[model samples]
Target chain A: MSEVFIFATLNGLVTGLLLFMLASGLTLIFSMMGVLNFAHASFYMLGAYFAYTISGVIGFWGGLLFAPLIVGAIGAIVERYGLRRVHASGHVAELVFTFGLAFLIEELVQFFWGRDTKNYQSPEIFDFALFSLFGQEFSAYRGFMIFIAIAIFAGLYVVLTRSRVGIIIQAAISHPNTVANLGHNVPFIFMCVFGTGTALAGIAGVIAGPVLTTFPGMATVLGSIVFIIVVIGGLGSLPGALIASLLVGLLQSYAIASDVGMPELLTLLGISFDRNHPLNDLWTLNLPQIAPVLPYLLLVLVLIFKPTGLMGNREE
Target chain B: MTMLKVSNLHAFYDKSHILQGVNFHVNAGEIVSLLGRNGVGRSTTVKTIMGEVEPKGSIEFKGEEIAGLKPFQIAHRGLGYVPENRDIFPTLTVRQNLILGLKGKEENGRWTIDDMFSMFPNLATRADVPGGVLSGGEQQMLCMCRTLMGDPELIMIDEPTEGLAPKVVEQIAVLLQEIASRGVSILLVEQKLSIALKISQRLYVMGHGKVVYEGTPSSLLEAHDVRAEWLEV
Candidate 1:
């Protein structure tokens, strides 16, 4: 039981950090453009498929390097030509534009790669288990993912806070007009930021594809969950996103691992329902069965109580 | 030499003509004020010059046509604008705000971060604090100093002393004088006639978006009828 708990925690940490990689970009783009891009996860899907193709020719390392570049360029083009045009139509139009974009990208992915799971695999070099705990082997790749996520977080922090371009970018996030008046090209900055954000999502796709299994619906599976993380953490708040991601990740993991459920509760409370009763489903409900909905459940509760989430500055 | 030449500048906000064929000019190293009441297109004129609004006339800066250019393009061409609302990047620290003002590394620029701090001691004390937390007066000072960091040849400042204590207003007046003495031209849009008369080398009273009165400060002061008809409440 203890080993299950430990491994669950480790796995939760890995998942949380991976989600952060995507959330960081999403939050930054949101704060700057004032638009919640619905196509962000589609960009992640593109990264995975692109890497899958490139990895076949140049191997995994080469795919990892080139795929994000390709994705970033595509992101820049979309922002320049597509998003910019829709911007004049207002926020709803922009949201619809991105939502349509996600569908279009998904269709394109299916057209090229087919509606099937790609046999994306972890590199052979890190196949061995890092350690054996309670007779269970912890694979080295999960540890590698944790490392990459932390490195990216650290790199993002340093670049945003300590560098010259970082200061300009930060200023642009809060005050694009003033930054423009200071002689920085505001449109170009917006393009770059949008591209950089998608590229971060691309990185996450490249890394997580093998573990999660590269498929057509992988984006749909994880995309809304990432949104839940951002909302739970706080909108447009980076630290908030990070905290929320880990909390959701760990909560789900622990809930899934634990066997306690409605059966245990019924037994403890001396309450039992007939199998044919209307409330039978409720009586038999289990934590593991509802683990997937934990984030959404929390989201609803948070919205009802504290609409701002944990650290969001902007009020709805 | 004329730093900015505006002739027959007309501006609009969705069919409501805000500036109706306004004309004005600022010369090198001189201080000029655009004095008018609220809604008289005083703010609209500067905004049009800054390319924040569409203008249907000539705006020649340093003898080059700049009427249709974008705001950043105009800014890059050595034109600075200090807006009435004082739009500072609230999340950034004072030092970061000043740093954003710089065009590039200060190789031979007149203003530096240190210079900004020394010019406004309040800024230096709150160098590490975010701009959002600053008092209204300090934010105004930050806005002016930030624009100055861009090292503009001609700065169009709108109402620098509109909402400040008497002491802060005095400091701002002194700063403006110091800015002019350094050979940087100023186009000040001010509501207070006393500040305008004291600081302006010349004055233009804008009425209904046209130059209703344009003269040296002494000439404008002597014209009591013009003062009552166009300026006095």
Candidate 2:
């Protein structure tokens, strides 16, 4: 039992930190632009596919460095030519534009990479076991993932709190027109921010591709989960995103690791149902079976109780 | 020399024409006030000149045509605006707000953060606090000081003393004089007749989107008919 708990925790930490990378970018873009980029996960998908192709030619390290930059440039171009034009038409137009962009990107990925999953693998340098716990080995690649996520978070916090550009971005988030009047090019700032955000997502994709599998359908699988993390964490709050990511990650990890089931609960409550009863499926349910639904359940609870989210202060 | 000039300026909010054929100018080292009652397009005139509102005429700043430019472009060319609402970034610290007002990375601006703190010690005490926590008067002072950080040749201030205490209003009046003494031109949009009359070298009385009368402060004091019709409540 203790062994299961330790391994679940380790796995949860890895998953939680990975989710934070994607959530941070989504929240930043939303706060700055007032529009949630529905195509954010699609950009993540692009990163993985780009890394897969680049790594095939120049090795994984080369792909790791170049893929995110390529994705960031594409993000900036999308903002400049696509999103900016629809911005004048208001929020609905922006939403539709991004939603359509997601579909367009998925199709583009399919056209370029095909439907089969690519055998993207972690670097050979981290192929060895870092440590053994309870006779089970833990790979160093997972440790590397955790390190990258923490570094990104620390770097982001310092830039926002202590740097000049960070202060400008915070000001632009609330009062864009006022920032522009103060002699800063706000539209240009928006483009850079959008690019940086997608690039962050690209980084997540490059790292997560090997662990989570890289395929055209990879985006569709993780896209909604990323959105749920942001909404559960609060729309545009960074700290909230980190907290919510860990909560969901741990919850799913524990559920999958544990063997607890509805049958045990029913027996403890002195309730019994026939094998062919209408609700027998509910009676026989186990924790792992419902792991995927746990985040959504948490989302509903958060929305009902704290509509502003855990740390969200802004009403809009 | 003319520091800022706007001739035959027209602006609209959707379909309604807010500024219709307005004309005004401020010479170097002059304190010019645009005075009128509410809804008389006094704020609209200044906003149009600052490029916050779209204008359909000529706006020449330091002999360069600036009409049809974006707000930041206009600001980069040395025109600063302190909006009527004092739109402070509420979440940012007062010092951070002042830093954002700096044009680029240049630190040799005529006004520094230290100068602002010394002028308004209340802001100095609350320099690290968020702008939202400050009182109405302090926000106004911070707003004006923020614009001054950009070191503009001409600053357009809209209703700086609109909702402040008498003592704070007096401080702002003194600050305006101090700013002008440093050779920065000012175009003040004001509702208070006495303050406008006392500080402004020249005054323009606006009515129905156009300048009804333009003259020196003393001449406007004697023009009781113009004041009663366009300015006085």
lDDT of 2 by residue, A264-302 (tens): 988999988898998889889999999999999999999
C-alpha lDDT of all candidate models, in order: 0.89, 0.92
| Per-model C-alpha RMSD | 1.3, 0.9
lDDT of 2 by residue, B107-138 (tens): 68899999999989999999999999999999
lDDT of 2 at B27: 99
Q: Give the CAPRI rating of model 1.
A: medium
**Candidate 1 lDDT tens digits, A240-308:** 888988998899999988888998998899987798999889889999999999999999988888798
DockQ-based class of model 2: high
TM-scores of all candidate predictions against the true structure: 0.98, 0.99
> Which residue pairs collide in model 1, if any?
none
